[model samples]
Target: MKKIILTIIYILTLSGCGLEQGSYLVGWWNGDIPTKLSDKEEKIWDICREKTKYLPKNTEEEKEKADMELNNCLHEKGFWD
Candidate 1:
């Protein structure tokens, strides 16, 4: 199961699908096929999607904080085990 998931990730990553988007989708799959995002997950996805827009304007410390917050958000939402 892990291998299959990893393979899919690898393929998606290499297919120019955007690693962040691919990883988010794969993690949210929760071992089943992913067909849609829940409301909460969609909110997180929106944040991630807009990150690049604001991240570059942030200072190093701000960026670090934002990254940590995002990581925590993902973990709290079960983006990964």
Candidate 2:
């Protein structure tokens, strides 16, 4: 009975840890192309989206610039900020 209780506790702890890790990467869309983004900006958007976890969730938006200008024009004006 003691061993069963320990096993359950361990499973619960691991499940909680998994949930925390999953939550850290929320709001990241998994797609080859964001339909709202332009064709020329799709590549940069994908890169930025994958790296979203490393960026601020609010206030300070992560902007990806290409060719001396912001390439993600569509995404810049949307929910990112």
Candidate 3:
């Protein structure tokens, strides 16, 4: 019975799984400074990169968005330029 209960808990946990949408964008926003990213942000970036591999190639607009995000991240990191 204990084993069954443990299995049920595990299954429940797994069922809550969901990917971070905009994670890559967030990562791109959070500058590339080694100390800038929290552990969670880094993980989100990795997941975004992996997931975006299946997305259609980025358009110019997408590229612009990425640049904007990167700039935001840099600004947050105290970069003025």
RMSD of 2: 9.5
Expressed as tens digits, the lDDT of each residue in 1-81 for candidate 2 is 999999999997886664532353332432333247565556655665565535443443333333213335436634243
Best by TM-score: 1
Per-residue lDDT of model 3, residues 1-81, tens digit only: 999999999997886455354455445556632356676666655555554445443798877666666656555544442
Q: If the candidates were sorted by their TM-score against the true structure, best first, what order would they fall in?
A: 1, 3, 2
Any residue pairs clashing in model 3, and if so which? Answer: 29-73
Lowest lDDT block of 10, candidate 2? 60-69
Q: What is the lDDT of candidate 3?
A: 0.60
Q: Number of the top candidate by lDDT?
A: 1
Once model 2 is optimally superposed onto the true structure by TM-score, how far is the C-alpha of residue 51 displaced, in angstroms? 24
Model 2 regions more than 4 Å off: 21-81
